[model samples]
Target chain A: MPHISLPDHLPGITGLLEFSQNTAAPIRELTQILLRGDNSLTQGERELIATVVSHNNECRFCTSAHTAAADLLLGESETCEMVKYDLDNAPVSDKMKALLTIAKMVQKSGKSVSPEAITNAKAQGATDIEIHDTVLIAALFCLYNRYVDGLASVTPDDSSFYQYLGERIVNHGYTRLPQGYDHLKNS
Target chain B: MAYIKLPDNAAGMRGLMAFRPHLAPHLGAFTEGILCIEDGLTKAEREIIGTLVSKLNDCQLCEGVHGAVAACYLDDNEVLIEQIKEDYKKAPISDKLKALLNIATSVQKGGKYVSESQIQRARDLGATDIEIHDTVIIAATFCFFNRYLDGLGIDPIQDSEIFRQRGRMIAKGLGYAPKK
Candidate 1:
């Protein structure tokens, strides 16, 4: 039972997005550009950043959704779990470890991110754009995490739903759901 | 003294947005949609929510910028913006706004900190679903903005008058989106 009457069919952020289409439009666009758009960072790497931040925030729905997406894009579930639980020892490159450290700091508090972290990331070959995108992705997921959980939106108990969502995210990217989903609004 | 080489002319979030032009429009549009659009929450109330979150997050730039915008809309009630920032619960405002601000505070701490009793209280005070939804979104979005600006160590504008002038322009419909 969400605080607001959201649709039953769409769970988590999807339902909240549908309920508020105006805000949802730009939000979807932002997510698509940050996650799926061409960049120096691979889509998998970006999803990893999102997963790590969501995990730090303890947002169950977001952590599950992005973890699944990351697993698919990276072609393994092990790495996502590794990044979530033990990022320091995760089998990623040194650059990714440094970047994830910054992401974790951002998740804690903006002030928590020290100048040393930025220096370390740069030394590990993380470019300015990569650093910029990493922080933006982390910050964006914070917004998503709070939005999804603040409303007490429904989180599907079924793991299969996350698998389907992971595929859709990897294949279709973030966009508005197809038509007839309008019937689900406020339902 | 930003960690990155953000544009020198623009300060705070503006500098960061200018640093990444391709992503700026979407971020701007989203800000416009949530804060500028007249929904169940008035633009003043929405800005108030954003200001409160920024203040709590200790992002002086966002707190000052949005607080000025909120004050611009509040006009004679401009002082009330500070009151809300200091303590919304004790401030003279509708019970509905008080309830919504409480929710915003919890969200500033963390998403899971928002309680069921808070939502129920807002509902009892006649807050619509959209109002509650907008309140949470505004609070959440500020968390993003605050971190983005602060995480990179963007410098805040020292002059309060600058924020007031910008706030008036925004209040007069110069929305968050950069002009095409």
Candidate 2:
């Protein structure tokens, strides 16, 4: 029921991305840099940020995708789920919990992220880059979540599909995803 | 009152840009790519999209900056900017622009809020696919931009003249690339 015609196989943002390479290339690059690139914030933590925002936004596809990624890196679905449900009580380090609080604030409104929030994060050993990445991860996931839901993209009921995608992304990263559909049309 | 150490004169995202000069380039590149780079939508139209979304997000700083930038291309009509912000549906604008604004508004609420009928309405009003596509991206990007500026507790400039000056620079293709 996507508003636009999308390939049945690709699913969610992947299918929509295949529709246009002009924008997709940059989006893909940005995702790789934001989620998978070199940063003090581990890939697992980054994915957890995205997962939390997606969960807050109630975006099923994104939440599922990032949840799987977080699960892969953290090696504990329970931990990931706990973070999603309640970061305050999650067994994560104090620094991580503080960062997640900031992420939640970003999910709600930038204005809601108060001075106290930054102070708390810093006290817990959150660096400027860590803080910056947390904000960007939360902000960018808003874009990704909205884009996928905006198009009415298809979401698979099967959880394994997302697990497979999560493993592939963890292994090869966001860069190697199929670029576009011109090849599909020719075939 | 800033949480993060920021330049004394800089405000909003600009202050953050000054604080972290290294990350500024990438953000500038993305902003330039989206707003400065010419595509199907005119620069004024794109600015209008940005301004509209900022207003929707209730980020006054962004609404002022982008609205003033939009005004540079729009003959400095402050009234029109106010009108568009207050109520774009009834604003004195073309049907196509109005339709596109509707799409942008829906984008501000959430992507899922955008219905098939909104796309059809824009198309019916003669908006091209690229125009619609750009509008969505512009709106979506503003959500990020607005959040970034506000999340850090950056204050908005009370002086309208400053925004007008910044707007002129952006309209002249300086973009958010930061002052060299």
Best candidate according to DockQ? 1
The segments of candidate 1 whose C-alpha lies over 4 angstroms from its true place after superposition are A180-187
Q: Number of backbone collisions per candidate, in order?
A: 0, 0
- On the 0 to 100 scale, the lDDT of residue A84 in model 1 is 91
Residues A84-175 of candidate 1: C-alpha lDDT, one tens digit per residue = 99887898999999999999999987888899999999999999989998988998988999998999888887899899889989998898
Poorest 10 consecutive residues by lDDT, candidate 2 chain B: B1-10
Q: What is the lDDT of residue B140 in candidate 2?
A: 82
DockQ of each: 0.86, 0.59
User: Judged by TM-score, which candidate is best?
Assistant: 1
Where does candidate 2 stray beyond 4 Å? A176-187, B178-180
- lDDT tens readout by residue for model 2, B17-53: 7765666766776677678756778888889999999
